[model samples]
Target chain A: MSESVNQQPVPLHEHGQRRPMKKRLWWIAISPSVWAIHFLACYITAAVWCEKIGEGNLRPLQISVGIYTAIALPVIIWVGYSSYRNFRRGDPPVPYDFDDPTDRTHFFGFTAFLLSSLSVVATLFTVLVFVLVGSCD
Target chain B: MNFVPSQSALDHAGVGAESIAGLFWVMLIGGCLIWLIVVGLAVYAIVVPGQHDQKRTRMLVIGGGAVFPTIVLTALLTYGLAMLPDLQRPAPEGSQVIEVAGVRWWWRIHYRMPDGNRVETANEIHLPVNEPVEFKLKSEDVIHAFWVPSLGGKVDMMPGRENRLKLHPTRVGVYRGVCAEYCGEAHTQMAFDVIVESREDYDEWLRQQASLAVAISDEAEAGRKIFAGSGCGACHSIRGTSADGVVGPDLTHFGSRRSIGASVLPNNADNLTRWIAETHRVKSGVEMPAFETLAEDELRALVRYLGELK
Candidate 1:
């Protein structure tokens, strides 16, 4: 059944299948993008608070950074989980089958997982900025 | 301003300097190591002609790229963050409070005492060794940075707002202070000398500055009259004389300063004469108008009078 499915000719006008293929690999970009967004959000909010609200009152800025970290971490973890699911689904019966598009999808999934792992670490680093650095003078 | 790190970060003048220097070294070493590892791996990948196992390659990427950076960055971030509060700690009790206002091309300093009285000085800042000094930094016109590299980090002086920085001078020596942020045309020549001396000497200097100028010679007296007639009082102020203008630097002890023209030139009769005659030639874009109308002798007398201000 798997060989027959692999042998089947892919349709030229089948836009639906191509979209899913691309969507499955979208996590590769989303993980790091989430990290960059979270970093900027935390930095900008802290700078605004430090300059405007006086450094003595840092609780509001601290809360905002905490919320940002909380949001970023979960999204990165979700990306990692999706990557893992896709990786398992795209596993070739014959390991290292580069000729097969399904097998190639597995490689992309693995790349997503690695990127998501790094993103999770980067998000934690951003959280560390709030934890370590003072919000104000 | 010169890009040279104000003084060697290795001097470890204060907590801020020490911590920053430590961080710099750590980053430098760690970065080099990381770069070498990455390059080595790339070289190995290029040179080695073999069919690599895909699963193993993925594992290697995860281990080397993600895991390595996370571990290293986590350690560095923790170490750096821990040093922040200590570097910004408030000055100790009995520490001196100096209000420094950053003008276009000079510094207006007010030494605030414990008794609520304030002593005003300009261009040069004198500090007592080993005493934690709190600088109340502000700007009259544009943003400026107060940086005495040997003491601590640079702090921005923003107009319409007050920022504070604490510096504890460990050594009794003169350090060059350059305005780290660019303000205007004369910013390059905008420099100040920070003299760190014993507490007794600093106190003595303040006391001397509080009084009027000492007795001027008959020759210097002629110069003072020329200064008065030239409408110098409209901009510059000499504490012991009738000249009291807030538009420019207070020349109360101008003669005693080591450098003039905002540390642009050595404080001497010739430099002062040239500075007064053509202010624009000495320091471009200065607020003080040139006094080219004054005769050569009159200019000399004015320079002589200012030299006796101490």
Candidate 2:
């Protein structure tokens, strides 16, 4: 099975050189736009919390809608295209070492922890601003 | 707005606000820092090649960080549960029981006093100051929320169900109450007032509400005929007459009541005219259909007759 497998390297992608390098560079530049999307996600989440606790106007549907459009979309494209680019570069495309089930579970748990932290820090900053500065009259 | 968090309500609110604000800040700060730490570990795990191989390193990251956080959450839950009883303190003797039914764009309030004499009104709720009162809440239609800031937390107003909340008024003031749910359009204007009065003032008011219907001019008799005839009796009820419509409040004492149109506006000749004519304009989402096209003379007579209910 090892002998039959195609190990020989191929071009990064069929259209690698066909498209202008500027466009590829532009896509690479556009990739960081995820941060803007994430910022919006964070801002909306904060708005939602304000509406819930501050005004009692927040609804679950509103939050879910905001997450998908403001948070999930940008993240999906960012991570997906980034991985694709690595494969296109022909540099050891797949790392089999990280495929262990335990590793995957750990990675997810680690991610959840970070997301929760973001929630905490964001809430703290919001409340501090309201308290110290008295944002609303 | 007698219900405005009285002195006791304010105290409840103050303490509640402090704890809420504290938890909010705690969640905010702690949550943010936790995110940073977890993200840092994840970034390291992903970028630092061969760092994934060391099981000890993995344990150090996951065990010390993620597992510990889970324990912290359990503790938070325990702490919250410990405070639940304080939220349900008992009402005092001779307390008022205000049954609040959340309706679209308004609130249907029924106050059943200790003597079994019941006073029902829409939108307007007046209570005595320094009294321990309980609210029996429900919704007539879709989901709604009962929320009065400067008092206590909120509870969902579910249909065909009842939820209760108790509060003690330590101050004499007016506070606003809002329907904190997204039931339909015009949700923004669905608001009410809690008018807390002094004990003596409340006793006098209750006595007035308990009296029989007031006398009206014989000329207003035409309006009474129209009220009973024009199918208004189908949706609204006048306790003294054959109008037993259950869709709306009992109008037996409408003429003597202090407010009108579910307390959206003061009960006056002109306001009553406008409400009867164009209720939807004043409150767009009001369940009652607009009667704006009614004739001028007929409107005057109808409003007068209704207002004569004492």
lDDT of 2 at B87: 54
TM per prediction = 0.82, 0.56
Residue A35 in model 1: lDDT = 95
The best candidate by DockQ is 1
Which sections of candidate 2 miss by over 4 Å? A1-137, B1-80, B92-94, B217-222, B253-260, B307-310
- Model 1, position A45, has a per-residue lDDT of 90
RMSD of each: 5.5, 14.6
Clash counts for the predictions, in order: 0, 32
Give the per-residue Cα lDDT of candidate 2 at A2. Answer: 45
Alpha carbon lDDT of residue B259, candidate 1?
87
Model 1 over residues B211-310: C-alpha lDDT tens digits?
A: 7778898878998888888888988888777899998988888888988888888889989888878789999999899888998888887888789888
Computed on C-alphas against the true complex, the DockQ of each candidate is: 0.50, 0.02
